[model samples]
Target: MFNPSPKQFKFIKALLFVLALLPAVRLLVFGFTDRLGANPIEFITRSSGDWTLYFLCITLVVTPLRRFTNWNWLIKLRRMIGLFAFFYGSLHFTTFLWFDHFFDIAEMLKDVVKRPFITVGFIAFVMLLPLALTSTNGMIRRLGGKRWQWLHRSVYAVAMLGILHFWWMRAGKHNFEKPILFGTIVAALLLIRVYFAWRNRGDGAAKSRTAVQKRQVTPTLT
Candidate 1:
């Protein structure tokens, strides 16, 4: 039901790339026009942070979508979407580092220590670095498939930490609708992954048992 030619896929990918940038581009336009609300820093920071979570959710959905729909092509887009998650995450962290701390490494460290929200966010951002660095084909080949998969599994932890960070940050304001919504989505995606893994294991075990039973019966017949 979902088959696209090479040219069509290329076109679609290009379209997604441009659409992904639209948020940042929109922020730039707002900044240029002095329209980022009264507190521009807060506006930009929140916008970047929101997009980071959004992209993370989108990245996590790729597997479930591909598996359930049988559209393998969705896997091709996961890397790009994951990189965008990192991109926005970097922007979110940079906003705090440059604007909030003014290049003061000491102060940044202090904030990470003194502030729980910053702490979780920093941890999450740090975890994204390795994933982004090793996202290339060459690195994957060097790391081998199993090791690479293990390392990239950090995305799940990063997703949880990110939600916690966002949740804590919003706690003071008593606004939790967004965090709760995204947290539910991430949780559902993770649970779906676990269910599929369990199902595969069960299927494999059943197949092995059946093969063994057939071997025993064949010896008796002979």
Candidate 2:
């Protein structure tokens, strides 16, 4: 009932694409202007990692928001936002791999082994690749709707890994503020998802029992 026309939806999507890139663009501008603070590499790494989590949190809440508001149009933007999460995540990993390790495979592997935060961060990025690859309609068709949905549910795992990564990274610096806040948001989103899933399952079970009860009574009436 509140659907936008094709043209309007296209425009909305175009606007969202630009909005999604604004963070990266801002980071780039800051880098060019030398506004990324004393340690530019650390600044860039933190900023990119922050944005990836921000996008992941935003993407996770989309469904809960849609459910509460009944605004189906919100879903149209979910894919775009999820991809941006992966985009920022890629940048974050590249910053670590290229700038931090200078493409040293052995060094990167050793760092992953030595650093708990980096290990989880690496795992999260690896999880994102499959989701990004399977995001297209073609891939969805190939995987079938149910399978696609199941695979994409891995986003929850990615988000949890992201939170763990952030928490451990911040713990080293004694900075738990942002980590706790984002963790709360992610927890809320996940709880909302579980609540709905359980509610729907209960509703389905209730319907089945009602149908069976009616069938049992029908023969007596005959």
Candidate 3:
């Protein structure tokens, strides 16, 4: 019912593509300029992780925004946003392994097991891997619609774990501002989906009742 012209769709895609590259571009510039401030590795790690979560939030918002705006073209950008989220997430993980742990698998595994925040973050990243892998059209087709949908539903859990990771990481400092903001955004997105699903079910029931009423009226007419 909601469709965009070909030209409009192309423009939207191009805009999103440019937006997705901005973070990587900034990272590169900062690296070259040695401008990472105080703790360079920590700066890069936190920046990438923040962008990953932000993009994930935006990706989740696409569906609800599309429904509200009646602009189906927004759906076309969802995959790109999701993949970019994974891209930043990979960078975040790499910064930890390469810069922090110096590729020390044993130490990293030990931390993952011992630290609840890292444990949750590691689990969230693992969950995102499959979603990123199946972002392709061919993979989606191969997985079949229902199965793919089920697998992607893990995003909800990923979001929850991500917020928990952020929350626990900040627990020592008692600073809840950033995590609270992120949590609120995730909650809003989830609530939108819940509301729409319930509304759709009601619509379906009403349609069924209408059909039944038509059948009963037809018998009387006969």
Candidate 4:
């Protein structure tokens, strides 16, 4: 397997950092050029939300890809990719809060309570907040590896919430295409993790049983 040196890994990360920001940059360019269609707010909101899902999908895919390809360096990029997911999620939420609600907290609360899609989206964004805040190495050390991993596992739930949000929102318009596709991708990514975990547990159990059998069969030492 070809392992990336530190410098090569940094270069890859830098390239991905820029590539990930392109969606936000495109939104900016479109806004400046008055190309956000007739409903600028809706366009911005949808675009940001779509990119959030895309990033989430990419973030979730990283682990499976790394394991399958044996490119351990790919794990280093996961934090950045995950943060980008949160970044676009922030943008998506900001559009709804700033443009849709005009910072009216009461109205926003009412909307969230009244609409199931908005409710799930609000919860998903709120869930992402903690994950993003605790993404740093310092935070990981502070939380400890096991605790940090447990907390970060909420990301799977967040992705599910995000899919539900999108699906419910599109239900009103009878648009199932994109929602179904995103749901399938997220579901498959999550199931891949589950499968590996189960297989590893089985492998460990088998090893333990083999060791026990060998010990039982061996003659006792004097």
TM-score per model over all chains: 0.91, 0.89, 0.89, 0.91
**Residue 90 lDDT in model 2?**
95
* Residue-wise C-alpha lDDT for candidate 3, range 1-222, written one tens digit per residue: 657688877887888889898988998899899898878888898899899889889888987897899765667678888889899989999998899899999999999999999999999999999999988877777876557777887898898898899899899999999999999999999998889767765777888566445423321110
Q: Give every collision pair in model 2.
A: none
By lDDT: ranked, best first: 1, 4, 2, 3
Q: Give candidate 3's error at residue 200 in angstroms.
A: 1.3
Q: Give the Cα lDDT of each candidate.
A: 0.88, 0.86, 0.84, 0.86
User: Please, what are the lDDT tens digits per residue for candidate 1 over residues 159-195?
Assistant: 9999999999999999999999999999999999889
Clash count of each predicted structure: 0, 0, 0, 0
- Across residues 75-137, which tens digit of lDDT does each residue of candidate 2 receive? 778888999999999999999999989999899999998988889999999999999998787
Off by over 4 Å in 3: 1-3, 205-222
| Residue-level lDDT for 87 in candidate 3 | 92
Go through the candidates in order and give the C-alpha RMSD of each one to the true structure: 8.0, 8.0, 7.8, 8.0
| Poorly placed runs, candidate 4 (over 4 Å) | 205-222
Instruction: For candidate 1, list the clashing residue pairs, or say none.
Output: none
Segments of candidate 1 deviating more than 4 angstroms:
205-222
- By summed lDDT, the worst window of 10 consecutive residues in model 3 runs over 213-222
